[model samples]
Target: MTTTRTADPTAEPGAPSTTTQASLYQQLRAHLAVLRLYDAAEHLPAVLDAAIAEGLSMTAALERLLAVEVDATEARRLAGRLRFACLPTPATLAEFDYDAAPGVDRALIDELATCRYLESATNILLIGPPGTGKTHLAIGLVRSAAEAGYRTYFTTAADLAARCHRAAIEGRWATTMRFYAGPTLLAIDELGYLALPAEAAAAIFQVVSQRYLKTSIVLTSNRGVGAWGEILGDTTVAAAMLDRLLHRSVVLNLDGDSYRLRAHQARNETLRKTTTGTRKPLS
Candidate 1:
């Protein structure tokens, strides 16, 4: 015998008779919202359709969605860290003029870009003459650290000293010192540009001492270690600070003529040629 079944009167012509599918979708979206998985919730419908079309298993589809959320969250976190870093500008190792500063160890700089020293809390000392790309290299490494999920801060030596001095006057020296020492990588640029007062020098020494063996520092200086005493105005204090910083540090000495001066000279030469070309010939 053959039997025929009739459709339910409540069913729409082209729609499912049961509300189970709609209810399940609503529940899934509610759970996603509650769990703060906004990205997944937003993309769920399209992703689900694609997954079904591709014959993906439920677990595989879920994994793919979660991966997207994870990547977005990590990107936002890195952006926040970069904003807090206060770098002079965004720079990268690729932008450096390796050929111009042949004295600089390109291999060593490439290694530093890997950011392994950060894990060991090792310091980096970039010593070079003015305009020899010391600050550029320092800033590049700081940017790399920030991107690699390390807390980073950048400030010139004079500015840092002034800030510390002000903090001392305001009786917030400890707080300021903690701020400087807290970052995973703290870059101090132009360390020998200006002579610091005894009090300021002491404050800087305190920062080095506090972060000793615990955090990394990227220092760019125009003066050599021997001249630090005169720059800081205290030989004993300089010696103590150097001892702590150099214990686990990589010193990179950049020896080259000033890139800025060379650029200036080239520009002047071009302008002179242009002026001569435009002048009338002497009879």
Candidate 2:
């Protein structure tokens, strides 16, 4: 028999023996394991077989294997970010109904969705009446920030104030401030929804000042800036906070009929039509 040297010099081969092939595969798997490429290691056998069947080059095969690992890594990262964000619900700019609020500037919203404002540490103020979709827009923007690999947090203004108040009482005020200030984009929803605790204005001001020119904020409020003093219970504190927030900010005023009310009216109309039809005899 004419002997031929296989790729592995010590292999007893005309073609590589099954034992040698298995040994090499095990070594590859071990190396991947050591590198913490668990996803790639798990998919190795199938990927390698497909690569061979397709006659792929070594570099191409490696690329294909690494792509799987990359995808899995991204999925894990996004899930972690979303969990940390504590977003009440999933909302995206694409899911918003611009037609429902004619006063909303669709072009401006599209621009904001690109997330360029975050890069400059700009604030976004969503001012509107109740049920005008301010919270929806704020959530959507924060989701975009999170998707863009920025650390994000979501909380209602009332909840944030209460937490800060409690933290102060527990003597963990500094830690609480750091937690709120840490996110690249901090979204405070439902500002002015309910009366905040006493000293809440000072707490909120500290959070805003801490992040001023350092990170971005997206706040949704039912009351306009003029009424913020009443909401925060201190005109002076509100002014100071607004000074920092508005210095580099995007203020979006969403003016329109309440989406919830519109939906309710629509349902009532449908019911009325159905009831009237039911009263008539079926010919």
Candidate 3:
């Protein structure tokens, strides 16, 4: 047995007709579908109910409906941007442990999050010892840029060099350069970690030179600038690459005990305490 309820007396004029609420809701959804406003259609019922219950005017109701759709569309766009970013992980600045790396300046990181540097194609260099959270900070910055609607990409320095070499071997040097240069922000992680090929230095230098003053770059390295000549096995190439990278860059140096080592020590301590607590006094 269907029970009929009266319409809201305070509902805005030109609201749905005196038909059953369910039928009117379905009809409105169908109309929205025909107009290709799927996001708005999905939220119509709630917005309509709220409007009627709150005695909102027609304009306010329409605005509320459109607002939700806009929000949903923006969310979808952000997701797409992140997916295209090719990030290694979904690390955000909020997840970074500031206390663990006291050398890092939180204020500087916060400023970078504003993404104003992207307009002028500034660079970010995360320099520190291994396990000093350089990669984490780079990932965080890349994620921030992605959220800010910048096209971003992430790759390790070694991987980038290899890809560049492979692209050259395949006779797609220009295409590879374009691919690396296409993103508004490119993150190169773990630079100078492993010994790269002899040609790797030039390959990397080309990439840096091509993107110079045209797009932003965020790179993490365990080695200092002075040591890059040895790491890349080419002093001249390394210096040229550094010139372009440092011209418009913010260098963040991280210093702290390795996070992995700290965790390992904590686990060992916990095990020792547990063993001691369970042991009986020796006879």
- What's the CA error at residue 275 for candidate 1, in Å? 6.1
List the global CA lDDT of all models. 0.88, 0.90, 0.89
> What digit string (tens of lDDT, one per residue) describes model 1 on residues 48-133?
77787798898998998888778888999999998888888877777999888998888999999999999899999999889899
- Over 101-196, each residue of candidate 2 has an lDDT whose tens digit, in order, gives 888889999999889998899999999989889988988998888888889999999999999999999999999999999999999989898999
Candidate 2, after superposition: displacement of residue 238 in Å?
A: 0.7
Error of 3 at 45 (Å): 1.0
Question: Model 1, 36: alpha-carbon shift in Å?
Answer: 1.8
Candidate 1 CA-lDDT value: 0.88
Off by over 4 Å in 2: 1-17, 279-283
Model 1: pairs clashing at backbone N, Cα or C within 3 Å: none
Q: How many clashing pairs does model 2 include? A: 0
**Maximum-lDDT candidate:** 2
Tell me the TM-score of each prediction against the true structure.
0.86, 0.91, 0.89
lDDT of 3 by residue, 10-46 (tens): 8654456566855776788899899888999877767
Which sequence of candidate numbers ranks them by TM-score, best first? 2, 3, 1
